[model samples]
Target: MAHDILISGIRRWARLPVAGRIAIVYLLARLITTGLLLLAAHASTPQSRFGLSPSMGQLVLGWDAQWYWWVAENGYPSQLPLTESGEVAENSWAFMPVYAFLAKGAGLGEWGAGALLVSLVAGFFGCLVLHRLLRDRIGSSAAMWAVTFFACGPLAALFQVGYAEALFVLLLLIALDLVLRRRYAPLYLVLPVMGFTRPGILAFALFLGLHGILRWMRRRAEPLPARHIVHIVALGAFATVIGFAWQAIAAVVTGNPSAYLSTELAWRRNWLTDPSAQFVPFEGFVRGAEFWMGQAGLPSWSGWLLLIVLVAGAAALLLRSPHVRRLGPEIRLWSASYLLYLLAVFFPQSSTLRLLLPLTPLWGALAVPRSRLYRWGMLGLCLLAQWIWILCMYGLAQTFWQVP
Candidate 1:
């Protein structure tokens, strides 16, 4: 009788709208994640951070979350903290202030709990915005599939954590949605706040510039409106300027103009080249690939070859697939720009997949036209992988390699 009721309830939920179904699935995933966290906490030492009556807030406030919380409660140090070697320690400058600052402003007694709440709410609405953007291109069912795949994928567990991804994604989606609708004035307002969230503003600006250029070329014979061109240029310039806002603020505060960039690039210096003293995109990935190859007992050449081949194959598929081709130019360009930003700037670390959450829209292309067996199999693997991520990333108390 209980099994029958469970099946009936699921069938009823499946009949809901795309956003509704996604919300239901997301809540279930959260429940499972929280249960796992509690069990792990029970098994941990009494003095461990996760031990005893672990709640959502306590479990999710790990790694970078702590950094954000620190910035929220104590504020950035007047001078950047440095290691014995005169390099900056993992300080607050590396994290953006949007989410943390908002939490601080709310005067939440426990910043971590506030951060977790912000992430949860932002993640849910982010999905709805994504779905709304997708509905016009693909049908509602396909859009629902995209949201489901994203919210339940292997890395979906990160959405529940007190990370910046949920907020970041929400802002970007809002900006993109506005741009697509030709709502320039509102977009101008969102650009600065969006830029304050992360360096993704750079990718977004590139998308706008490239998109505008293509439009100009197509209408070269006809005289385009000067006001339209001005708006386009203004949008691009706004995003570019805002992208540097935090770094400029940090430089002023530290009285060291190079403080922000120097601290950020320091992490890459260890692997790429010490004393390099600048940000070079893709350098981190190259260094990381070499290090990982050595750990896997594989030749460096083999690793490079494999990475190149895989990237090439994925590009080819995206270009050739009819589903991908059907996507609007703005969506295509944004995905391309964001992927390049990742390859160039982001280190291929344990947190890499979590970083790729912004690429959620692209998953819509693959979600459509798949067999039930294939879809279910992929979801099962993703769910199983989530547990492994929790175990290796958070459950263990030792010197875990992955930062999550």
Candidate 2:
């Protein structure tokens, strides 16, 4: 009887629309994963990292979640806290304000755990919006595969966590969809919110700029309308200025004009001996690779070589994919610019894979294979990778520097 009911539910789920199926599958997977994690948390020693939350649901609120919760519960410190030597300590200024702001107003009894609920709900809708965006380009079948691949990604656990990736991705896709549809009016509303949420808005803005240039070139024979002129100028300004709003707020609140930048640099400074040193791009990844490789008795440069190979492989696969080729200029530019932003500004750090969540459209490219065997094989591998990531990076990550 129980087996029949479960099979019946699976049939019903399969009969639903692509978006509905995506949502149901994603939420149900999250439910089972969360329950199992909670059970494991309860079974462990209370003092361990994995045991940080026996409540299971709160397990998603791990490291960065604490920083966001700080902003939500206490707000930014009027006076930035400093170390004994006058250096800036890690604080809420490093985190953007959108998730914190929403979590604060959620009215959940505990503001910190409320963030997890916010993330889960946002993730569900984000998946649906992602499916919708892909469906317009690929047909419904390919789009469904894209969403499935996204939901079961190795880093997909981050979506269930209290991170702002879900919210940021949802806003970005909505804004991108509006642009694709030539709906500029609603973008004004989302662009500002996106700017407030994450620095990825700059990439989105660049994508929009590229889209505009291509459109103008195609329509060069036609005279530019007053409305197009307004939209082009307005959107460009919105993207450029809004990305820096949080930095301005941080500067003003902390009373140090460079508070935001300094705080960001300070994270790098933590591992460096020189307090006055500047952050060098790829330095962290190189250094991290050296340390881990040395432990395995490998040459220090092997780490650097490995990173180069991995990046090159990913790029080759991305560019060669038929699904990626089907993407419009806007998405292609957005993906490229966003990856550059990650490389140049964000730096190759521990959370780099998790940061790639905003490039949700890449999953569509990965899903382009028409073979059922290939799709199912990739899905199975992704699920296995998720389990491994959870165990090594989250569950038994007590003594390691596991950044999710």
Candidate 3:
């Protein structure tokens, strides 16, 4: 696996050179992140609380991580459909099947267990990937900072708890960096992995397609580059094929093209601004309008922050140096994916912050230019917002997805 290869490479490449400093710093950041995650799990444990105290064993092992476990153990159970709680216990409902597949084959615990295992594995590798990405664009010191901010930042709290985002970001960042390097085939390979990692990946296909079109248009007087067009078409086609393949198989087995959707929770994130969706949207409004308005605004402050960070990241990419400008395609692909997420997912909530996690390391590297005070302040703000978002979403999300 690339993870193993990266660890080996880091050891040799960083042992006798200036790169060693960044390597040490990056490893230290990973340690800090790991420590903080363990501490958070232990400190706020249900054990300290009353009857509802969390099963500390499950806390570290895998219980809150159960949904993914169920999916992997069961493997897209069509007959079961939605569980009594209106939760889908199938592969589709679990969102990403690759992790589940890996977990299942490895004899990991159920989906949650597998997710937890993968989360840890992914988080560690994620730091390494972040270090590599930033090292190329921002030099060693800033690269170390970028890696640190990601693993130790507030988001680390939730990310370490066996969630998909941690693993997902590792793939996204690595793949994006590959794209920036113009390693087209490798990027394409990562693109499919990303596509399966999360539904939001569809945007990447569109972004790549757009880039190819723009490039061709800019050079229309010259003959079209077959390789460029092929890459774009191939990327888009792969995304579509995998997508329909899943739905087609599920539909054949379940008698519903959208069997996974039907099997999932009743939450119906169907793009409708339901009164059920918002996070106290009614608190600030009048009678009828206020309730639905708040419902629509369930994401509240965090949503706006996501928009700002995304825009800021995009702007930063454009204004960067020529060497840095090489990053344009990667940035646009990530930006497009996030934008698709913002639009496709109705009633965005704090969890939406998960979607923004990959962008942190890159943005952290970019912060090297600003004053230290401002950079630290901005980091603080992002961390605070992430904290608030975790609190709000963790407690509230279960409302939509129930456990057996």
Best by lDDT: 1
Q: Which lDDT tens digits does candidate 1 get at residues 23-79?
A: 887788677777666665565554444554455567678778888888777877779
Q: lDDT tens string, model 3, 61-91?
A: 3423555555566666556445455544343
Please give the TM-score that candidate 3 achieves against the real structure. 0.69
TM-score ranking, high to low: 1, 2, 3
Clashing residue pairs for model 1: 282-344
Ranking by lDDT: 1, 2, 3
**TM-score, candidate number 2:** 0.86
TM-score of each: 0.87, 0.86, 0.69
Could you tell me how far off, in angstroms, the CA of residue 391 lies in candidate 1 after the best superposition?
Answer: 2.1
Question: What TM-score should be assigned to candidate 1?
Answer: 0.87
Candidate RMSDs in Å, in order, are: 3.4, 3.7, 8.1
Clashing pairs in 3: 46-53, 46-54, 65-112, 68-111, 69-110, 69-111, 69-112, 278-295, 279-298, 281-294
For model 3, the local distance difference test gives 0.54
Q: Please provide the root mean square deviation of candidate 1 (C-alpha atoms, Å).
A: 3.4
User: What stretches of model 3 exceed 4 Å from their correct place?
Assistant: 1-27, 30-57, 60-64, 80-92, 105-114, 217-225, 263-265, 269-292, 295-329, 358-366, 375-404
